[model samples]
Target chain A: MNKLMVYMFKNFIRMLLLLLFVSITAFILVSLSPIDPLQANISQTALGSLSQEQIDKLEMYWGVNEAPIERYLAWVRAFLHGDMGTSLLYRQSVASVIMQKLSNSLMLMVFAWIISGGIGFFLGILSGMNRGKIIDKLIKGYALLTASAPTFWLALLFLLVFSVWLGLFPIGLSVPIGMDAASVSLSDRLQHAILPAVTLSITGISNIVLHTREKMIDVLESEYVLFAVARGEKRWEIFRHHGLRNILLPAITLQFASISEIFGGSILVEQVFSYPGLGQAVVTAGLGGDIPLLLGITVISAAIVFAGNFIADILYGIVDPRIRKGARS
Target chain B: MDRIPILDIQNLSVSFSQYVDMFRKNDLQVIKDLNLKLFEGEVVAVVGASGSGKSLLAHAILGILPYNASFSGRMSYCGEPLTQMRIEQLRGKEIVLVPQSVSYLDPLMKVGFQIRKSVNDKRSKEKMLQTLNRYGLGEEVEKLYPFELSGGMARRVLISTAVMDSPRLVIADEPTPGIHIDAAKQVLGHFRKIADDGAAVLIITHDLELAIEAADRVVVFYAGMTLEEAQASDFSDESKLSHPYTRALWRAMPQNGFRAIESIKEADL
Candidate 1:
């Protein structure tokens, strides 16, 4: 128990450092970008109509008049006190906007994650067990092709085929247009999420499949597996007794690590589908130069990705005693 | 000695199909005309240099040879033809292999559960404990994983796993490499005990001296063929050994002046 606490505490320190680095980089990059918030947020006509006094007030309010380091420090001070500030474009608290959008993104991401992991794990084991056969070739070819394919492009293709061509699903968005948020049914939300989730899952599936397949092939070729085979263990028995536990640890690690990929892919997927999730909000906040909103999303996403990796680390100790012993020592 | 040997291999040959060129393939024979018999209550060691098809012979008997390899031989287990299907049925139970190293034990599995395989009944657990105890391994060792075991403990665990089913034929392939001399002898001593308890033990190793010490009979192999078959007592004197290669091996022993033969080929011998 003491060892576990130490391990977790170390990981917590590492996560804090990573998050700090990510936030600083995001802040610097956003500050240096060419997008002028005054122009990007307001039209030329609206800017021209404003008097010098009104323009000065707007610039001061947006902290455009402040030095980059001063503005960053001020934002950090506010952030530490649970004050994420307001989204200039949304005219709402950045924290509330994030909370609203994050729920939807989590639903989409979790759905895709489970689907991709389930199908990919099964296919990986299948292809690895039947290596060099036609099924293996087919799965390998699919993984190769999909791994190189871009998420936005796949999302567009799904939108075209499943929405425009077949008319089987919505073209975009988390809820039906013109429907009240309180009135929307679970089935309706599920229907709207299907295409986006499917697109994200398809792109995510390739990595997990390839990694798991390689691990499976490695396990099958190991000396212990050969010993199991020589001991009169049949195919199913070998997989159940020897193969599964060996492959499962790596599979779980890959599955959790892929969370970052899934989140990144969700951004492009959300754009193509115009889904009103955290991914779409990131795009909106970035374009509108809503620094507070952008930074909040950045910190949260980084935390999530780090958490995914941390979970994988903990699970390694649980699944394999060898690693557990190493960690304890 | 039993009238029918536990395992008999006659005129055995093994070859693998390999692609020599882009479009051409050929069969490369690795073992030829190898013959040996392992009777009940005896330990027979097949001693040879590495890659002399000693391990291949073990794989052959267990029907675990590589897919591309082909063999022509007549192998019988207790007077019955040991066909592929028959070996498969008897594998892990009536017949078992004590693999070369602890690496042959599943790294992810507990030592006790691994030996029992899927038999989780209370009685099977008791038997597994008994088997471990027989190998001087305590019940506490059962809960440990393979990596947690020391070199000697790992070796004992392998031996325990093999004898858990009370197999009639036990084939050990290079069971004591990279271990201390004392520990190796202790491991070999376990095999001697297994044989004394009425199981036929076939040990494949490169250490001729160790083989002679533990085995009742030793078969000398050279370039995939059995060069000589002699009683372990015969190694005490060069004259008692028939083949020149076998006699050269005797002279090469450290106890006997450690004579260095310039070459091991038949002509040189």
Candidate 2:
């Protein structure tokens, strides 16, 4: 237990250092870009008659007039004190704006994760158990097809079929335009979430299914599995007792490693569906040169990636006893 | 000596279908015309070099051969035909196998739970602990995983797992390799005790000395065929061995001066 605590502490330190590095890099890159946030903000408004004095005041207020390093250090200081600065694009606190969008993205991610993980695991076991059979072949075909198709195109295709033609789901937005979100029914939220969630899930499912199938096949052929069979353990019993944990350990590592890809893929899907999620938020922030909002989103996203890996490492220690021993000694 | 044999295998042959190309297929005959038997209260050791189909014989009896391997054989256990279904039913209860690979233990499982085969009852748990104790393993060892064990401990755990139910028949495939000499002797001694308790033990090994020391009978295999079957005392002198290969193996023993013979390849056999 002390060893596990030390392991977690070390990983926490590493995650903090990585987040710092990401923040610095994001700040520097945004500073080096040609687009000036004040100019972008000014151009976005209908203020052709505004005086130069108003522009100067706006620049001072936003700290754009300060040296890039000075501004970054000030931002970091405030961030450490729980202030993520005000967004130039939305004219709201970056934290408040991101919190609203973060929840929406998390909801989409949770639904996609559960759907993809459950289906992928089940299909993978079936395909692996019946290798070279028709079910295996069909799953392989689906994997190949989804792997080749782009996420945005798939999302659009879903939208066209389910929304435009069939009218099964809403075309865009996470909620009805006129309906108050707080007053909306649970079924209304689910109906609005289905298209974007499914679009995000399909790609993840394909990747996970292929990975799980490969790992399951390898585990099924291992000496221990064969030994279990020789002991006359029933097929399901062998799978449950021996096969599932072994296969899932590596599969989970792969899943967590692919989290960045999933995050990136969700951006395109979110755009296609106009879902008010972090992915869509990041895209809008980037285009509008909202550096503060972009920096906030980037740091949070990197933190999410690091957290995923950290969770995977902890799970590794739990699942494989060798890892726990290694952590101790 | 008229007791019905616990296991009787006659004219057992195993051949595997192999794909030579996309078009051509061939049958690779691995074992042919092998015959062996084990009566109650006896330990029989099948001794041969690697690739001599010794392991395949054990797998065949256990009905765990690969999907493509086809075999023609008559195998009986306790005076009844040992069909696949019957073997499946009897396995882990009436018959058990101690596999050769240390990798055969599940890496994720606790030693005690695995030995009990996940039977959650208090009786089985106590029995599992007793089996581990008989193998000279401490109670704490039950909580350790396969990776935590030394080679000898792992071998003992495998033995403990097989004998937990006091199986009627036990087949151990190369159960002593890589273990210390004393540990090997201890394992073989345990097999002797199992036999004395009325279970038939078949040990497959390449160590002729161990076989001669531990087993009541020795069956020699050469190039996937049974070369000779003899009383273990027959191995005391090279001249008492009936087959040239058996005599060659005896002479090749370290105690017998490690005599060298002309290389006889599989093609020559």
Candidate 3:
């Protein structure tokens, strides 16, 4: 337990460093975008309410007149206290906006990951079991084609075929707002999620399939596997006992990388379908130069990547007894 | 003596498929009409040059031979035909193999984990620890990784792990292939113990001296064919045997007693 704690502590430090590096980089990049929020807001005259005095007060209230560093400090202070800044477009707290969108993206991410990992891993195992069989060849060919097919393009194609052509879904939108989160059924969200999930999952799943197949093939030929066979241990025993345990290391590393892939899914598929998630929020923020909103999304995305990698590190210590011992020592 | 041999192989011919081309591919006959066996309480030493299908014969009996390899003959465990049995049915329950190189063990895992893997019962830990101590390794060996040990240590660990469950037959391929001269005796002693435990042990090596010292019987292979089979004491005197290959091999050992086998090449071997 002490060793595990040490391992966890080291991992925590690593995550913090990664988080800081990402947040700083994201803050700089968001600040670099040329659009000014106040400048974008004057044109909201189409809503036809505010006078010049009212606009000036609004600018001062949000610290638009303050120096860049002071404005950054002010936002950063509130941000540390859970204030993500107010969303100008949504006319709501930035935290509230993200919370609403985050769940949708998370649901899509979870479903897409399950689909990609499940299908990819199964095909990979089959391909591995038959190194040069026709199925292996066909899967490889298909994976190659899918890898080259971009996510946004795939989303558009799904939108055309599934939504537009067949009218299978609600034309790529989230669950209608103001509905009770509890009464809003799981299957209903899943129904809205199919095209976006597929748009994201197919390529990732194919990549994992290729990787897992190669890893399984390599592990199958090891001396322990032969030893296991000679010991009269069943084929499945060798696979699960020796093979799966050994293969898990690389599989998990790929899983860590897939977290980023999941985020990438949201950007393209979510934007294409206007699912009102982080991707859509990012677009709105970028268009209106909402630096605080963009910065918030950027840091959260970085945190997710850092957390994914941290989980991988913790798993490494568990799976590899050597590392676990080292931590103990 | 037992009425049925622990294992019996009769006129076994194993062939492997070679995907030479699109149209005219041919099968490579890896082993041909080979016959060998291990009897009750016997230590049988198979001596051969590499690629002579000695290992292929081992694979054939183990039922882990590649899918392309096709074999025809009688191979059985205590009267049951191994030729058609599943790998799980034939191996470990009746026959267990300790591979030549000890490198395949997960470098990260300790000695205890590798041993306990084959013997799946939870209480096997105590038995494994006892076996490790019996092999003259301290309890520290159980805690150390493969890399932390010497070549001799790794070989012993491999042998100890193999015989943990005391299975009926243990097949050792080139058991002393990469072991130090000091470690070869220790490794061979392991097989001798297995055979003494009333389990048939098959030792595969090119070193006739080691075989003569360790085995009750010796089977010689030349170019994937068994050329001669002789009792261990008979080969102790080199002049008694007359197969040209085994004779020349017996002559080639510079120091008649315990000649070091640096390599197993056939020509320059």
Q: Is candidate 2 or candidate 3 better by DockQ?
A: 2
Order the candidates by lDDT, highest first — what do you get?
A: 1, 2, 3
DockQ of 1: 0.82
> Local error of candidate 2 at B185, Å?
2.0
Q: In model 1, where do residues sit more than 4 Å from their true spots? A: A326-329, B18-27, B180-182
What lDDT tens digits, residue by residue, belong to model 3 across residues A1-329?
97677867887788767766776676666667666667675565542577778778877754566777776777778878878888767778877878888887888888888889888888888888677889989888888888888888888888999889899887767774577877888787888887787778896888998899899988888776777666666667677677777777888888887888889778888899988778888888877777777777877888888788778877887788667665666
- Estimate every model's Cα lDDT from 0 to 1: 0.90, 0.88, 0.78
Candidate 3, what DockQ?
0.43
Q: Tell me, by TM-score, which candidate is best.
A: 1
- lDDT (Cα) of model 2: 0.88
Which pairs clash inside model 3?
A231-B91, A231-B92, A232-B91, A232-B92, B265-B269
Candidate 3 residue-wise lDDT, B1-269, digit = tens: 55788888899898988878887769888677778878878899989877778888778878778877888888778777765554456466556788777665765456677777745575787888788888888888877876677777778787776776768878888889866676788789878888888899998887777888899999888777777889988876777786766766776676664344445456531
Cα distance off (Å), candidate 2, residue B266: 6.3
lDDT (0-100) at residue B124 of candidate 1?
87
Model 2 agreement with the true structure over B1-269: per-residue lDDT tens digits? 68899999999999899999999889998899999989999999999888888898888999999999988989999999999999999998889999997799888888788888878899998888888888899999989988888888888889998988879999999989977788899989999999999999999999988999999999988878888899999889888887777887888888898998656666544
Better of 2 and 3 by lDDT: 2
The DockQ assigned to candidate 2 is 0.66
